[model samples]
Target: MQLLIVTAHPETQSFNFAMRERAATVAARVGAGLSFSDLYQQGFAPTPGRADFQDFPATQSFDLAQAQKAHQQHGGFALDIQAEQEKLEQADAVILQFPLWWGGYPAVLKGWIERVLSYGFAYGRDKTLPAKKVLLAVTTGGIADEQDAQRSQARLQAMADDVFGYMGWRILGLHLVHGPADLDAEQRAEALNSYAERLRLWLSEAVPLAA
Candidate 1:
C-alpha cells in the first residue's frame, strides 16, 4: 500500500512534526510506501494564478478552475504542483497533518490543494483518482471537548465531505490531538503513542480508528 502524508506547519520541531513522524512509524510497521510533502520545507508557493498555468492567456480573465482545466488538457502546471499531484495520484490513503489554525486548514495546505488538485484531476470526470480514503489528523488549541474543538471538528468534517467526499473518496477518520503543545512530556508521549495506535489501524489495517 502507498500512503501520502501532507503536513503544513512552520516549526520543524513542533508537535505537528512529531505527529507526522509518528504517522510514518505506523506506515512503516504496516509496510506501506510513504510519501511526504512538507510544505514549508519545500518552499512551496501558496498562491495559484497565471504563473502556475502554462497555456492560459495572460490577457484573458484568469479563472482558477478554467485554468486548471486548461492545464489538464494542455499539460502545463508548474513542477511543484505536478509533483504533489503525482503523490496524491499514487497514494492508497492520504493524511493531512497540521494545527487547527483559525478553525480551518493552514493557508499553505489549502493553497497546495488548490494549485495541485486541478480540474478534471480533482473532479468533473468519470474516474478522477480512484476512491481512496482520506483522514483529517489535526492538532487543536484546546481539549477536544472544548467548544472550539467541537466546532473545529465540525468544520473540518464539512470540508472533508465537500472536498474529498465530493471527489468520491471515503473519509476514513478525523483524529484530533488537543493541546499537544501544552502537554507535559509524559502526556505528550502518551498522546503520540495513542495516535500511533490509531494510525496503525487507519493506514495499515484499513480500519477506521473509532473516536
Candidate 2:
C-alpha cells in the first residue's frame, strides 16, 4: 500500500512523533510505500491568503473559491500545496496522527485541510480527489471514555463526506492513546508496539483506492 501519514504537533520529541515513527516503521516492515508530512516543522500556514493561489483574479476581496477554480483550469497551486496534493494523489490510504487539541484538530492541521484539500483539486462537481481509505490515530492528554471515541468517529465521518465524497472515506481504524504523558517508559513502548501491530493488520486489510 502507498501510505501518507500527516502528523501535526509542535514539539519534535513529543509522544505524537513517537507514534508517527512507530507507524512509519510498521509500514516499512510491511513493505508498504510511505510518505509523511510534519506540519509544524514545515511552518505551515493555517490560513489561506492571496499568495496561496496563482493566476487568481486580482481583487480587493480575495475569494478562495475563485482562486481554486482558476488553479484547476490553469494547473497549479502554491508549491507547498502542490507538493501535498501530489503525495495525496499517489497514496492508497492516509493515516492522520495528531493530538486532539480542544477536542478537535490542531489549528495547523485544520489549515492544512483547508489549503491542501482545495476546490477542484480535492472536491468539485466536475473533478474531485477522493480518498476512499483512511485511518485516524489520535493522542489526547485527557482520558478518553467511550463517548470521546464515538465523538471522534462522528467528526471523522463528517470529514469523510465533505472531503472524500458521501461515505467514501472508509476508516480502517482509530488508534487513540489516552494520557500518554502519564505513562511510564514501558507503557509507552507497549503502546508503540501495539500500534505497530495494529497498523500492519489494518494496512493488510485496507481496500485499494478507487480507480
What TM-score number comes out for model 1? 0.92
**Candidate maximizing lDDT:** 1
Write model 1 residue lDDT over 55-94, tens digit each, in one string: 6676999888877877777688888888998898899899
What lDDT would each prediction earn against the true structure?
0.84, 0.80
List candidate 2 stretches off by more than 4 Å: 128-130, 144-167, 207-211
Cα lDDT over the full model 2: 0.80
Best by TM-score: 1
TM-score of 2: 0.87
